[model samples]
Target: MPEAIHIRPDAARPIDVAVGILMRPDGDVLLGQRPAGKPYAGYWEFPGGKVEPGEDIFVALQREFVEELGIEVLSGEPWCCVEHVYEHAHVRLYFYICRAWRGEPQSLEGQAFAWQGAFGVSPLLPATIPLLEWLDRVRYAQPS
Candidate 1:
C-alpha cells in the first residue's frame, strides 16, 4: 500500500528544528501563544528556534528553549519529526520531548503560556497541529 506524499530536492539550507518541551506524567505539556508583532505571532506553538551551523542539537535546543520560553530544561529525549515548506522558507523539524526543567516558565518574550491537558486541547500554532496530534496519540495510549 502507498500513501500520498510530496518530495523536493534540498536547497542550500534544507533543515530547521522545531524544539518542544514535553511535560509528562500523563499527557500534560506546555504551549505558548505568540504575541502579536512577529511572524507567526498570535498563533500557539512549542518553543524553539532555528538550528545553527556547528551547534550540537542538545546544546542548541537548550539555548533555544531558554531564549524562547525562559525555562531551563533539565532533560529530554528524541521524539518525532516533521518537515514543512513555506513560500519563503523550508525546514525539517527535529522534535524532542523535554522531560524535566528548572525555573518556572516565564514569557521572556511577551507570549502567553498555558499548561494544556491532552484531550480536548487545541494547538496554539497552526504549524504545531501535527505535533499536537502526535503528542495526543502518544499520551492517550497510557492506562488511565
Candidate 2:
C-alpha cells in the first residue's frame, strides 16, 4: 500500500509562473511540449517557468526563454493573467506577449516546438486554454 501524505493548507499555495506567448508577424504563436519528467509532461504550453524569488515578471520571462529556448527576448509586454488549480499545484500564470527576440527559438530543453494558428493545436495544458481564447480575440480584432 502507498503512504498517504498530508499537505498543510499554507504549503499548498499557488505558484507564481511567467509565460511567454511568442507571436510571429504572420499570426502564429509558439508552443512547446513539456519535457519528459516534468509535471504535465508532453502537454503543449507557452514556454515559460517559475518566477524566482525577487524576480520581476519580465526578468523571469527573459531568463526562462534563455534557459529553455536559447533565445533572448528582445521585446515583450504584459498580456494577461490567469489562475489555475491542478491536482499537484495551484498556479498564477503571468502571460506576456513576446513579438521580438534575438535568436531563432530552438528547444534547448528536450521538448518539441510548434508554430500554431489560433485554433490549430491540441492537448494544451489546462492553464493555456484561456490564454488561447484571449489570443484569438486579440488576433482577430485587428482590421483585416
TM-score between model 1 and native: 0.78
- Tens digit per residue, CA lDDT, model 1, 26-143: 6687777767886676667777878888877767888887897777887777777777776556777777787678777888888787887853334455557766666766664543
TM-score of each: 0.78, 0.86
Candidate 1 wrongly placed segments (more than 4 Å):
1-12, 119-123, 140-144
Name the best candidate (by lDDT). 2
lDDT of each: 0.72, 0.85
lDDT of 2 at 89: 85
Q: Write the per-residue lDDT of candidate 2 for residues 31-96, one digit (tens) a residue.
A: 999888988888999999999989998999999999999999987878888888887888889988
Best by TM-score: 2
Q: Which residue pairs overlap in candidate 2's backbone?
A: none
